[model samples]
Target chain A: MSGVLTISQPGNSVVTDLGRFRGPRYGLPVNGALDQFSARAANILAGNEDNDPLIEITALDFRLRTDTDILVAVTGAPVTLSVGGRTCPQWEPVSVRAGETLAVRGMTGGLRAYLAVHGSVAAPVLLGSCAPDTVVGFGLKLAEGTQLEVRRSVAPIRQPYFDLPLFRLGLSRPEFGTELVVDVTDGPDIDEFGDSAGLLFSSSFTVSGRSNHIGLRLGGELPERQSSAELLSRGVPVGAVEVPSRDELLVLHRGRGVTAGYPVLAVVTSMSLDILAQARPGHTVTFRRTTVAEAAGALRTATRQLENLRAAVTTVFGLLGIGAQPQWHDLAPAVGS
Target chain B: MPVNAAAIEVHESGDSALRVVAVDADREANWTTVHRLAEWLESSGADGVYGAVPTYDSVLVEFDARSTSARQVKAFVQLGLRQLGHADTQVRAPREFDVPVVYGGEYGPDLERVAGQQGLSTEDVVRLHCAGSYVIRCLGAPAGSPMMDGPGFPLPVPRLKDPRLSVPAGAVAVAGRQAVIAPATAPGGWCVIGQTPLTLLNLANEPLVPYMPGDRLSFIPVPAADFGGYAGRYLEPAR
Candidate 1:
């Protein structure tokens, strides 16, 4: 059944899906959840469409009171999730009774946590997505006292709470730590760095506090250019490692601009992008060089894993009499321009 | 090289996108080639392709690798480019839009600074800014921010070396012969000249933005009192 959730503690959260699609034509960036793998896992566990909207809570505590019974899953970095003061398991669906309060005490591992309801978190859709993009003025923030609608096209979940946790499909979670060995492929302008091109991979950089959704500002040995010539403006893809005139090197994310003028030295791989999403400010980052073929392979593997999860979850939902099933195709995090 | 007379190159962007770049050409020719390719991809009904974003000298073709690999999309794009070269047809004219701006006040804090830099009065700065019909060259980065090109000042204006950390949204600024509007609040380095009240992007309004690349925009000076009336309204272009 459909329900309402009132945010008691927002905790820098926003509703996100695969992000706003087909936005580049209108000069909008593709902004969605920072970690695609975790978001997909949560969606699969909750038996919701892969692109359904979910709450992305960032590095803080959150609390919400519900008006009806629903199944939910918390993914992304490890966190202490609770329903009515009793701790609940993450990465798996748990039923919450009507009028019970759900809470995320704090993130124990990574920087962001995702909460996916079995029905899906409902928000106003703009263009093709309901993802909150402040820059484009699409959806608003999930602040305290905001009433959120939890919608599902199917009937209310009918499975018993005791039988739900039996089908725990194991999915490997990405390791998080103070230091990260990020994989990257060559960008279009790698040769422009001359001798400094090698330094980009060899040097250990510190993520500056100024870093945010747009990109991560790295402080370390700067990649010096061989020429003083100005680079012409061109399309800047997400994950491009740009070396601007400033001292910091930039690793663009989903929220970066559609185009830029800085020299690109490398591009983070699609699989590794999920790891970078959880990287905190002041964390040590070391670049590991890889080929485009390898990068593309990693992306393929991620999609395949999700497909397997979708298949397993489909059978489980069918057995439980739940109608909604996961459609993993086109669920991959959109490549930002 | 497959495209006759046009020097265009397509490079893989990470694993999910491909960038079509123009090689060794003037700004006009570069943009012309990129925009044509972007338009072709948008209208070609190509599957697995999401959208193409045309910038100053390139077009970023974003696609879904799951449904179709970059290799397949790249092949399709190459074939489309060859066909585009064979036809070499010009696109329809861009729509014209009049952007309402309030010059030289709180809306445009650097209007006086820009005038002083150009050795002209604030009135001259505003007059000269509104004199030329500009074209939206590209959009990106922050949000729906657009960089425009036009018959600008006689001399290129230098950017604020110590750039403002937080330039207000709708602020219109210029640098060299290029102009840009801050679609939202962010840092800016260009010399501010005026501000427009028309929202550059709002999904509530259909078509998202009234104009796209190649569209013409001319600024119409309005009193600060009238700026409020234009607020919350999308920038609708006049055909």
Candidate 2:
């Protein structure tokens, strides 16, 4: 028999609640599970595939209810997690019986968190996804009294021990004090700025409060065109820093619209989004120039590290006599070329 | 990557993907070619293609490096392009939608201001707006903000020098030669002429947004009294 697990946040959690609409809708942007990495990690701990649907909590305010014992893991945004109204350690597997309530009191710094259960949530799918599009009214934004049915799927014998992510994959450790240097490449409007435009990388910018899932408005040196040219409206890539007429730097986010006409400066690397997603409204953000080759290298290293983490978790769990599946498979499929 | 290929420019976009740009203008001329290539690769049951989002002018095809290599997908795309000269079908046909708007009242607080700036009466502004049919030029400024272009009014009205932090949803705004309706309550800088009760977006609907690129749109002057009856249907059903 299938039981239920319901989790929710107190208020709007941008990445946590914003997911793709699982209903009929073409324009609804998928806004769910911000830290895909952590979500996958939590799923692995539950002996579930990386793609298992889970609840992403922001700034605490999460409660898990069940009629049967369910294996779960909490990850992302160092939140003080409690089960049945009692404090417990996070980033590890915890089993909860029926009627147990899990709550995240608050967060240390990061803005979003992920809660994974042993089975998928019973939410309708739109565009082949179970995520919600809150802004566009697509899917369920776990409000009060949202009941999520959990299937009693076969649980893997081995479960991986969950740990926090590293600097590249997790929150920035103040000790790492390694300034978050985001690498960017030229954009369609890159040449719009004079040679001084290249100087943009040499300067620092602060994240403005106006930032949102749509885009990040950066404050600092503005890039301009050498001569005013009306750019034909075209598709904008994520991370593309667009300079609208106001001269404010609008860094496009993952959910940015398809087309735009603003003068673009550069696009941030994918690795930087992890940091960008966590950046508060007024965090210092700096851009560093990188060649196409360098960007490829960075991506390669990041992908490899992620693969290694999945492998490590698998190895650790296998040693525990639990035959947990590899976690990386949760994201992209593992098809041989 | 494959035989019968033109020059291709590649850029590393992020830690997970690379962008291969095809140099072309005349967006209309390339739509079929781009769509055909993207569709062929996706339908080929090829591995590594994870996130492939197609847009008006380009297609961003992402893949997992572990499962597929860029060179592999590039070669596959090149193979499909060799047949680009063959007969093909269109992607999505352009559609026409008539949007009803209520002008010059509590629904549109700035209607008087816009009329004053344009040297036209509030009624005259409505006449001009309804008289012209607009083309969907682009969608931007905010998500789902449709930028339509047509024969603009005789006098150019400037946008509010100050943008409202939160304009009501379904706001019908005009700036220069363009006009649009906001899909959500968002900060806007356009001159608000009125608001529409029509929901341009509904998550529960098959297509989140009712309008598409190249869709022709016309603004119908709607009465404020009839708004309440039509408002809920336009929005997604309350879950």
Candidate 3:
């Protein structure tokens, strides 16, 4: 079977991974899946590596048709996932025959969803990643009728996708909705914000439409600072919450710059990034203060869950006779029939 | 100036990264040391440490938290900190860049405004900018945007009260005695007085921007008609 997927209705879809390795040092933002937990879940369920390139569909109306039989999964936000008119539950692997239409629509919860096909996106890898950053001229957005070249392995499935008696998999996915309470630790320059620092936790800020992979802009009651003094530009992390002068509060994300001029009022916990990334315009956002120890523990727990997930998915893939090519996994090389 | 652990304050930048602020009263000295520390960490093969980004006052070190704990990464950072300013470590040689610019008109929309603020003719402002020596203070956001010192014109001009929503890439801008070339189209507050046709930072040419801190810089005016000739060429820094 020809391994190709044609975009029938591309809704802001782009190839993304964990972004380029060490991208910040070269002035490139880490342009990857905003909600990584969902991305990994989609991949694991599809019998692919966690960080493999996959399609990240934003908002709604993302539809594609497969040119070959493949195992796939859709995760992130509560969405209507339909394959050839058959509705399927998310986070579960499904077999799609050639010429079948896979549609994801009516996202009720999150703003972005991850679609992992059991194939590799045939996009040119720049600096160790297929993720595109328009600022750097790396890759382009997927267009309607554009056929994405995919490399597939001769993986076998026991039966049809809709008829498979698979157990529903439950994992620790962040709650996605219109409202979000993000956990944050102390930022490097928290002291300069003065008593106004409490304003961040006290007020609810509405997400702005201007937000993107770079950062999320929140508009609401402005927090005044004690100093108008010039702070030298410094390297900032992705989760840094910045207070730009006379502007809205900005939470830096994956596509944020390595450095900025704004003063950081708080730093969002890494575990909360998945929830923060899915926030849409007009979404109400509140902050919760947390200790550093708790933040690290959250990540530790998530890491262990993913490790166990990989083991479970890999075992199931073996039982179903779905094996990847030598390139994907040499230890379990597939005998392409 | 001696670099010490006490002089550097490490703050938690999310769970996976650390923001190390170098406390030095002198801005130039602070950035120079920060740049040195970043270069050392990169050139050496440090385990678990991903990358270190240096700016005017601090460094952000992002690491693989799954393999390394925050305490382990912090210890690695401390080890790297101790290696700074040592005579044994090879230092990056500073170079010079002659950036070509097309001043005035569409390329420099604020040429007239900058001239008026400085109480001089636009030609004088251009000439002074061309003659003034500048140094890249740091490479930063929006794709290695070079923040620089010495605009070559008089007066430490204040930034725009309302920053322009979109400053085009390659636009030569100045604010508060500093000059910058927008590496990409982004929101900025600096006065755009000119533009460079040469590619400042491109992955195909060089991953890192050609010039770094301590590099000498001076602008050269190019005829508007000849601007197209220099487009797409890499910025070649010379010693």
Tell me the tens digit of each residue's lDDT in model 1 across A1-337.
Answer: 3357889999889988877767766777777888988988899888888899898888889999987767788989888999989788887777787888999987856888889988786578877887777666567588899887766433334446764545576777678898989998888788888888998887899989988877988999888888877566677778999887568989998877777877778889878888888988889999999987777778888888888888887787777666534522112221220
TM-score of each: 0.91, 0.76, 0.93
1 or 2: which has the higher lDDT? Answer: 1
Q: TM-scores for chain A, candidates in order? A: 0.91, 0.78, 0.91
Predicted complexes: DockQ each: 0.61, 0.25, 0.67
Model 3 agreement with the true structure over A1-337: per-residue lDDT tens digits: 4577889999888988877766788777877888888888888878778889898989868899986676788888888999899887788887777788999999867889898987656676777788888776677488998877666644435445867657455665668878799999988788888888998999899999999988899998777777888777788888899878466988998888877777888889877888887898889999999976788888778888888877888777766566633434222222231
What stretches of model 2 exceed 4 Å from their correct place? Answer: A6-30, A61-67, A80-90, A97-106, A143-146, A153-178, A245-248, A304-337, B1-95, B121-124, B137-146, B154-157, B229-239
Task: Enumerate residue pairs that collide in model 1.
Answer: A1-A156, A257-B141, A258-B141
Per-candidate Cα RMSD to the true structure, in Å, reads 4.9, 7.3, 3.3
Which candidate would rank higher by lDDT, 2 or 3? 3
Interface RMSD list for the candidates: 1.8, 4.7, 1.6
Kindly report the TM-score of the first chain in candidate 1: 0.91
TM-score of 1: 0.91
